[model samples]
Target: MHPLNDIFVQSAAIFLELATSEFMRYILAAAGLHLLLSTLLKPLVRRRKIRPAWPPKGQVRREILASIRSVLVFSMLSLGAVWAVKAGWTQVYREADAHGWFYFGISVLVLIVGHDTWFYWVHRLLHDKRLYQGWHHLHHRSFNPTPFTAFAFNTGEAFLHGLFTPLLILVLPVSYLALFVFSVHMIVRNTVGHCGVELFPATRGGRPLLGWLTTVTHHDLHHASPGWNYGLYFTFWDRLMKTEHPDYLKHFSAAVRAEPMKRAKPVALSIAIAASVFCAAVLSGSGRAEATETAALETISGRWVTEGYGAVVRLQPCDKAPMELCGRLDWIWDPASGSYLGMEMLSGFRLQGAEWRDGEITIPGKNQVFRSTIKVLDHNTLKVRGCALVVCRKQTWRRLESLPHIGLR
Candidate 1:
């Protein structure tokens, strides 16, 4: 094949892979979370009998089709990314240590702020009378948005929005890990914005330092009435441009204050007890070797203190991918530290032979991942070893029954 033809072929291949991967990521993160939250809060929705109903009929199907198209557009943008990186047109660095940790940290902050600005302006442009019908109407169709609405942009809008990362890399030197983190943050915030529930605490949304941040109510209102709140990831632009809805706080308060199911607490408690009993019975009835293996598996599934005591992570079975184990950061020891709670620290682990292998462990603050292995050492201790190339480090973590309170008296 001709050289240019070869590039096209490669880009096409890249597009397909990226499209499939992005679709899975979006669906799993958005739809899975939507299902979990909707199911868990079904009783609350029922009791409150809110208007516009949870997930209007035919809305999910339309959202899915629109999202599929958007993912394709995003994949085309990814093709541009691949070509740019190959042609030496981008400043994306592979080594996290290339510019040191300080530069890496600053670059991530810059990337986020830059993207927020870009999104705000582009979003406002999409809402223009001339462009709204052609470019953004598909997304606005979801008058009562759900998490699936997060990626349900028209092809033109998706292409425009997806250009941010590719363009950012052309001008700014960012570590690959930083780019990955930014992408994850974008999806999570986007999903939460369209989740149709106000997950933020009622008080936090009213505080001076935090009140400026946008919430679900802020974005949902924009979906309900499309002339304002065009910012993404933050409220800086909306507040500065005076586009924020006046009654945002009031709507948020009412949404959060809606009555929860009276029986939810007792139902949750009963389920927890039943699960505990089932697990205990299975372990107690097994033979010696079988019981030991079961105990090890159970031991691995709980709160654990990380090696450096920097964070506490909970290891649990991934509900979407049941064959694999996942670990998420639950808390950090340093209250002043940057927020990393709820981020996945370990993922894709599967048991092979006597040990849990084929997993990747992310070292928070370091922006690095290592091929990792976990071995249950008795019932209280776990041996975790991570290797980068040939250099390897092993850490012993103790299982914690619960997180420790670290605040000052």
Candidate 2:
């Protein structure tokens, strides 16, 4: 067989394995949680008569169909993960001790936090008027969601959501077990958020400590009113941005107050199990940290389009100094205006903590350099900011796999 054919065959096999496994995981998680909460638990826990019945009329069937479509789309996207793992582009490790138990816990936390951040931004983006009708309107169809609505996403929306996992794995070192745990955590939280009942206790002003955490009511409000409550796992972004629904507290209080006191044992047991798992993850043994070459710079190497789509820059390793980062203008929207192609745009960047700072970016039209910082929002997005004294300009650039045809405007 040809070398390319051999590689293709191997990738196909990996994709099949990953897709099948992921599909099963989605079905089991969504279905099992739905059955447990909507069918079994809700009936047992009701203390008083609620105005609206659970599951609502006709919502379950729509949710089921939509979720099935989402599963297929997600399964297809899992191929990207398989390719990354096989090509050694991902930081996935088979050995649990490769990065130590402590690092494993940290990695899991990072994945969750990273995922929440990504979801919040992307979710908000999808709500944009230009994108909402095509990308996100299908999801809002389920005004009163059941558990099945947890995974019910439009194909475009599904692809965006599915892309997060593969992108995260590419940039971060994660173990197989840690990824599995993250998957479980994702599904459980997703199911509870859409479960249509408040499983958390009511607090005075929603409890200061728990306020940062999203509850079932938080996402439920998002469905009820699409503009507010755009968080998936954490409420930090919504709270900070003041996008949370105004009546969120009143709704949460009503839901919590309705829970029957007689069924407290089951809810308590569930919380206890979750707490134990968290404790175990944190208190696990520490091992020797792995000493490996940092690929932090390589993770950000790619072609990026400027925010206004004004210019395209290709980022690569500096030839003269391998440790330094450099970018050159590859294309300009208006070539007749003054071709900047091959002109250096970025240089002198080094990794500083979570961001790549102490860099300089040349202003395209004006022959001037300004202090700049670059941070990888994800595998396909870079946040670049340039500061000139008190005046600053920021742009979120999207990665391009290949350069496009540039013509004079």
Question: Model 2, range 170-250, lDDT digits (tens) per residue?
Answer: 888888779878887887688767767666654444332277789887888898889999999998899889998988877
In angstroms, how far off is 305's CA in candidate 1? 47
Q: Where is model 1 more than 4 Å wrong at Cα?
A: 1-5, 39-52, 204-209, 258-409
TM-score of every model?
Answer: 0.61, 0.61
Global local distance difference test of model 2? 0.72
Lowest lDDT sum, 10 consecutive residues, model 1, at: 278-287
Off by over 4 Å in 2: 1-9, 38-40, 43-45, 48-51, 56-58, 204-209, 258-267, 270-409
Please report the candidate that would top lDDT against the real structure. 1
lDDT of each: 0.72, 0.72
lDDT (tens digit, per residue) of candidate 1 on 1-409: 2434434544565677678767876776676556545565455444322134666799989998999999998888888786688578999876776899999889888988888899899998998899999999999889888878989998889989999999889999988779866766677678768877665434433322257667777788899879878887788899899998887767766765532446435444543443343333323322343455455556579888877676778898765554467899887777655477788899967664467765789876676787777888867678998776655678988777533453311
